[model samples]
Target chain A: MSGTLNEARLMALYHNPSAASELDRAIAQDPAAAALVAEWRRQDAALGALYGPVGQEPVPARLRDIILQAETPANLPRSPWQIAAAAGILITFGASLGFGGSVLVARSGASPSLVADALRAHETYVVEVRHPVEVAGSDAQHLQAWLNKRVGMSFTPPILTDYGYNLLGGRIVPVDQGAAALLMYENAEGARITLYIAAEPGQGETAFRFDQEDGVQSVWWIDGGLGCAVTGDLPREALRAIGTEAYDQILPAET
Target chain B: MAVLDEIEAAIPALRRYAIALLRDRDAADDLVQDALERAVRRRADLRGEGKVLSWLFAILLNLVRDRHRHLTRSAHLVPIEAAADQGLPPAQDGSLALTEVHAAMGRLPLDQRAVLLLVALEGRSLAEAARALGVTEGTAASRLGRARAALRVATGRDRQTGTGGES
Candidate 1:
């Protein structure tokens, strides 16, 4: 059967069922289309049965909490007090700028504010299979150059061969400083991790802060004038070792 | 009566779609929660012409695609064998070839998988699936064909398998 006619036949069975009889008659002229439709129906039935239970299962409590929290006044249309609080926080950061580097500090590690953005980005991008990075890992130099150009910081993709993670690629992200960058890496086991960097000129050095959500672990720190966060699903010890090594390689180069 | 109530009614189906796509319960709920939250945040943007369920499914599908975009190609794994017997049909429903189907579905590519789930499993009309994915009906049809063919090969059940041209 010609490709177009064969497609029309199969499509007739699958989508445009009103025309299925005509297509089936044409498909009967070709056994291939009929067999294909049969198999497709079987597969569809299987898919329906396998996943249908999940919807019937009890909804997880955490999901409800997520919705409830998202609906809270702070996250929804910000209440007047919430808007004023945001203004206060911005003014606080602006005032902190006067302090010398290493003096302007947060409650802990990379500041409390940046942690949320880093976590959110980690959640969003780490699940991507294709187009994970704007520049593919095959061209490490281009990935670095692209991120550097977009983020206005000379950043290098850390070599994590020792830790079993090679550079997958990098992309530019938004931060309070206008631009940030993230380089994702994956190991032989297929576990993905990323290192996020932002220019924190004149900001204080950070004590490493760690966070975990949905089985993924993350660590953030500041070295020199750059604020960095490294996040993944690795064990705390392993993630820290990798984060520390990356810090040694990239941050020290800037100093 | 209310848009949110309408949205609440669709949660089970949305959750089912998410689970079929991700194959993980927590991950599926996470996706469902994200869709619902986005719906609330962008409530003003939804026009009455669009059904709340369709709009919510669109959001869930987008989130799945976003996850697909950042995830590595090597990480696709389906433990269909273990989970195969989890869905035993009631005595009258008859035996189902669910495990084989799931394994095959899991091995298929994401785009194909999405098209198949929306149409074959979810009972979404071809045009509705196309609208949800923001693709033409023909594109949706083409994806479905490829998806079905791919499943046949993956399942090793391509009985009467004439030379396949995926037409």
Candidate 2:
């Protein structure tokens, strides 16, 4: 086997078929080339065997936690859209309501406890793989009816396509207040926003309320005695937009 | 997220690749974190869910390259020796041959190392490896050849010596 052909064959071993055949001819002609190819394969195998287990090693939780952290001042968006919205909200509430602006804030005014429960469920289920929802979006009608019955009213699966999210599915999860209907929507990127809704026995119609904690944002509201919350780790404005979209599209309540 | 679980599922693999690239466990985790943060931040741009892994790898590789360039700019070459000292995992304890194999890999030039790791160690096909590395199949193939050849020298297990002899 000519040394040139052997080199080509050696290179071909890592490439497509045409180059692989050249190794066959080279091996027949040159014993050295055959031995070299054999040794190279052994090295390749050794390296793979040595490093393969790295994949099996438990991933450090810190890696995932980093995603949830509201990045430091250096990493925070310098001019987020939420800044403007926050200013607007600030002007409205802090004017005559300066006595207890913090307490009078929309987020704390609505069912704060229920909003926390909804955020928990969103975080818990958003990362789920095999069973995020009991009934997928394929059976949207059944899912709607089932959830509506479970929660004692129609839980309108919000239309979010205009905001780049399509309904993935929904489920029912127990909340501190009562059983809540959880509907998950996904955008093209697999980023999901979960909406949790349940009948509020004593709560009445309320205004949009935004809550931010640990980089997860959830907008909670009460509409006609129904509590609704949309949660995700999205830009503030985006989450507000989703919350508003879902608010406008929610199924009407029974008088 | 529709494919959020799927992306999350690939974390272990990404961590492994990061470990191979960065050598130190803490550094690797940091690199993975940065990659995930960037991916999550830019989630809206990820239209093709099927390419998520490749997309993540591309982002990871970009971060690695940026860090390396920054380090190099500061006059520090990549800490190849750190990986050499880390050696193989505990399971490979007492396996000097495997330790040498791991060290030999660390000694590989970054280009060749990436190509070899993607194709040979990580089991990516040539096309997929090329896609991940942003190179042509021919370039990836050639780099792989050079990497294997370099390993043969670094490990001193060439044609005559490496003849079914490393037990």
| Tens digit per residue, CA lDDT, model 2, A75-165 | 2323665356435544543363444434434547657667766766776678767667777887978988867755656557878889888
**DockQ of every candidate:** 0.25, 0.31
Show model 1 residue runs off by greater than 4 Å: A1-5, A16-35, A64-255, B70-72, B81-96, B159-167
Where is model 2 chain A poorest over a 10-residue stretch in terms of lDDT?
A68-77
True contacts kept of 1: 0.53
For model 2, what fraction of the real interface contacts is kept? 0.51
Separate clash counts for every candidate = 9, 3
Alpha-carbon local distance difference test for all models: 0.67, 0.69
lDDT of 2 at B85: 58
lDDT tens string, model 2, B42-71? Answer: 877888757888888888888877785443
Which residue window of length 10 is worst by lDDT in model 2 chain B? Answer: B69-78
Tally clashing residue pairs in candidate 1. 9
Interface C-alpha root-mean-square deviation, candidates in order: 4.1, 4.0
